[model samples]
Target: MNDKNTTQFNHENVKVGEETSPTLLRFFRRKWLGIWQSNPPGMGLFVFGLCIAVIMAIPIVYVIWRSLFAGIDRWQRLLDERIPQLLWNTLSLAGAVTVSTMIIGVSLAWIVIRTDIPGKKAWRWLLAMPLTVPPYVGAVTYIIVFGRSGWARDLWQSTPWLVNALGDYSINIYSFGGVFLVLTMFTYPYVYLIASASLRKMNRNYEEAAYSQGMSTSEVFWKVNLPLLRPAIGAGGILVSLYVLGDFGTIAMLRYVTFTAAIYFQRASFDTASAAVLSLVLILLTVAILWIESKTRRKNKYYQTSNTYRKPLTLKLGKWKPFVLFYVSVVFFVSVILPIGVLVYWSRIGIRMGALDGRFFGFAINSLKVSGFAALLCMLFSMPIIYLKGRYPSLITKVIEKLSYAGYALPGVIVALGFVFIFNNHLPRLYGTFYIVALAFVVRFLPQAMQAGEASLSLISPRIDEAARSLGYPPWKVMLKVILPNMLPGVLAGGALVFVSAIKELPATLMLRPPNFDTLAVRVYFEASESIYHLAAPAALLIVLVSVVPLRYMLKKY
Candidate 1:
């Protein structure tokens, strides 16, 4: 009887051990393998994402590698002379622009979406229209109107009293104040769009709850709406900050010294090593901004737990309607109307002066060719990256998605510099080709493509993929036939964004284009920089017109 009891006890112990072993194995698998090991399909995506990550990382890696080997002499020189001023200039501008955009964007978005101000719908489009005008283009127009030699100055000179009173006190468009104003005007749209969308989608239950608890409208906004809008505001602020950080054209045109302009000058002087070092520092600043945004975003998760959708009630601006209208009008006038009006005025001048010659046609065609190719490539590459990130949730997918945005934050000049090193050393034959310019566009604007693609793909259900597969349609066919049709709108939107961006891109085209290969942007920059406003006006006008294609799409999407 004792022997039988002991044998039974040992059998029970063995059973218990067997039961716990699988749990331990699963824990280890989850800790180590993550999503890649759990789903069989994930392995393939993991490899694909890894490949794309490596490709996307090459430029950043090249910049870092070059910087490290850029001898101590270059580093010391930069530290002593250039880095200090550049750091102060870059950071101050980025900080000021980020804060200003957030204020303007968030305020305008609230007025449009939440207030029953007259013409709210029209205001939405007008507010967003500024995005179509590149900041540098806006700077050019502002310079034409407000610079020392601008219309305002000329007009003041014509008035004896005004001229005497304001002698030598004309607005200087080449100062820090000018850079801040131009950047803010063009970039606030980023914040406005995001905030408007967030406000539109916000579940009113929270606000209602706050109201029921005896909170006033002001209190409700402060206690509930603003907190919920944090993520959207944070995202928009990141974009604006990154834009300010990476801006070369606007700052250069305005004659402000920042890292981007410094890098361009360094590269022009064949100081590639010092340029790399500056680029590395710029990358660090970008990374820090990204990190802060990530932390802020992660601190709160805003989602509706219920599936009920309801439109928010617009607040009646009974007494404040005129004030609100004036505010909206001022923003639109400064950002869109003035710029386009000035361009149109100067374009007519250019036409009269025969500035639209054969070379002008060449510039237009070159712009179309490079922008078209870049847009196509962006749409093509965005597919797989968006597919993996959308259909599969995994560590690898997240990494690739983040890696793809590196270019969006880094200056175009830095990207051009990286390619300069890469092509010169590895593929000397391809160094001066137009294709290199297209590649630079692809790198700089891929994030826009990815954003559009991911938004479209997220609306699709995975069950559809399974159903197609079960119907004996292979993965490729399912993607090509079923997915492509549904994704066409988003793909086109992405392509349009890339096209607009490429057309307006200044630094990359300036740096990478072959000799005598001028795009509209290049010609505009050259003519405008030389103070030949009439000659630059036509190309700048064309760019703004092309940019309008995506504006309608954005109005609908947001």
Candidate 2:
């Protein structure tokens, strides 16, 4: 009887334990929903972010799928002939440009931000103006000045001494060296902006501490400042590397073949399968670069420890002022003055030749219509993704945020190709529409919009969200009523960035636009490619003018 009673007691104990233990669903609910009692992202937000992620991921998925099923013959052809050479050319050029830009960009930023450079306020704007000129436009300008049959060569040939002494020593702007020079000139601004911001916000106390430890100014910079600046440099370098990797127009114009150019040629020849294989390789290369950047960034986390802050100490150039001034002048001259000056000079000639005719108006309208639509779509889509990421800070939201950036990292050519397959195969009805062009723009430039949205959303306190929730506002309503109105400035800034990027986008537009539908970028590209400089000049100038719209925002941001 006693043994039976003990058995019953143990059975009751086991039952009580099972009742108290947490189930998987219950545990997840407590952790996820318990984040904010007043304002948590609902199930709807998660579903929305997932849907966006899937859409953003389509291009990448399509490329991979096509590449894998490209058949053994196509794969072998690329592997045996094209892939080896393209890989070398792409990596070497990307590495060279990245190193060159980092050196120029970091130095120039330090001089402008940290030194007592004369006319810094003007110099800052001047330095950043190069970003207004697309690398292809810059390449075209350089070619006009330095090509074998260029104005520079014509002038030199006229001088007997120059011709005799420097026989066959003319500048060849179509070679690898020329491509490197032009790209570095335009792309260095990426690094400069990032490094400049880091320098501006950096706590000066570390530098002072280093000085007190018997470090010279140079020593302090090398030991204290540079270590802290690594994250900024890495971020900027990744952007430059990606730009170099994905660049088609600059390299193609200069006649140096990379993966982007190779893929374009393959597709032009109707070798779609081969293009997919090449695109997969390029995507892998880009992924490796992104991985390296993330690893480097994770290894270092720089932040100010105290709230007490002071302005950065200005370094006196002293005897080196003239040299610094000369350096700044030369960079500005090469990057900004030369390109715009060439455009203006040629634009006058084009105007005299009546190149800006009725067709020009059509090109302008096409550009505006497409880019405007893209900007609007980007703003619309960016809100939900960024809002979820910024306000909720959950694993799902973080994954969605990362996936959104995948489109931006990809080359425009790859994105365009993916859309060709997707639209032609899946959505055949929407294949040749202008909306396809707009969608391409959205995919290639959406991250810019998301970045701006997140920045704006981050400044609003969660308390505001709680207040809205207390008043019985749903997540969507709160976003519409409270969050968006407060973040309009950032939203506008993002929209402007998207507009500028879309206006300049070339490869995707070239691939995706309907028959006979030419944007300004396409006009400029075709005219320039056919050596019709006079015709290309007007459109190029207009692009530059439109690009200036975002100059103030960029300046403030950096």
Candidate 3:
């Protein structure tokens, strides 16, 4: 009996073991298969997105890592000697620019949107035209008009009474004040565009309610309209602040020292470790500003909850019409007319001097090559990520989307520094090639492409994705064959934007361009620095013209 029981127990154990083993194996197999088969984004799409994200993230990651191990002495030395001044300069400039932009942008947006200003249509586009001129180019224009040898200086010197009164053509375009003025002029458009849109869309109920309570027009404006504009104001403020932080060309050209300028000089001096440390600090400052903006935005939720939407009435400027028109005209003239006129005048001189000769054409061709490549890559890369995000809506997709914007938030100098460390250390073959510069451009401007493409893709229904899948198209194939064709206009527009931005990009190109491989932006920077206006003007003018595409795009978008 004992022997029989032992054999039965052994048989039972063998049967249980057999059942458990295949069950576990099947579970594991199904889980593994699910990654490839259970979703719209199959293994291929997911891997491609992952690869792009990793590449996007690697430079930033490398910079952070490099900074962490850059030696405590280097950190201490920079912190004591450099960090204090840089922090003050960067933060103060950012704050000053943000505030000035807010005031100007909000006032201009209000005047255009709420008041009965003449030629509102013309005023709208003209006001936004400054955006077409890059701040650095604007700086150059201001320098031409206000620097020691500028037209203003010449006029002041030539006019004896003015020179005696103003004391020696004392307008220094290389000072902090100059940087502030140039940035404010170009960046106010950010606020103006957004605030104008918000003003237009704002529900009339709140203002009417305020009026019913016997509130004055001025009171209603302050209490009702201004409160509603906070979100737009916050968004514009963040943009301006971030731009100020990342600006290399404007700040550097104006001879004002900020973190970006300091980092560039450090890198130039071969102090890579110190540069990395400084970059990390700048990154922290950027994060801090973004965080504060976020916190402020979150705390103030001004949603127009009423479903009944009515457009607000446009107020007659009455006796104030002339003043308002004058203000608008002056803003337009200073921001748009002056800078562009200078470029055109100088360009005419440049052309007369054979600025569009073989060498000029070569620079133009070089600009086209790298910028075109970057734009194409951005358009191509943007599709998969936007596709995955729009369709999948998973954590992985969200992370990928965020990673792709890493370079956009980073300053060009920092991005260039990251690429320098990465390429010099690992990608030796591509280290000094224009390809690296193109890639950096891709990183820096990919978000612009993504935003445009995502705007287009969001309008598309997932049913289209489903139908394509039902017809046996894989996710990748659907994106390529169906989605891409539908979204091609927006994608192309996005590509155009990237192209313009890459064409204007200065610091990254400066850092990454191969020796003797000068593009238009490079030529502009070097030529302008050396006071070679004739050479710089053509490229600067071309860039300005190309930039108009985005201005039109923004006008439509806003």
Best model per lDDT: 3
Candidates 2 and 3 compared: the better one by TM-score is 3
Over 126-230, each residue of candidate 2 has an lDDT whose tens digit, in order, gives 898888999988988998888888888888888889878878546879888999999999999999999999999888888888998999998998888999899
State the weakest 10-residue window (summed lDDT) of model 3.
32-41
Q: Which lDDT tens digits does candidate 1 get at residues 258-300?
A: 9999999999999899999999999998899888888878878
Provide C-alpha RMSD values for all models, in order: 7.4, 5.1, 3.0
Question: Model 2 segments beyond 4 Å from truth?
Answer: 1-40
lDDT value, candidate 1, whole model = 0.88
* lDDT of every predicted structure (CA atoms): 0.88, 0.90, 0.91
Count clashes in each candidate, considering only residues at least 3 apart in sequence or on different chains: 0, 0, 0
Query: Least accurate stretch of 10 residues (summed lDDT) in model 2?
Result: 31-40
Return the TM-score for candidate 2, rounded to 2 decimals. 0.92
Residue lDDT tens for model 3, 157-205: 8899987776887888899899999999999999999999999999989
Query: Which pairs of residues collide in model 1?
Result: none
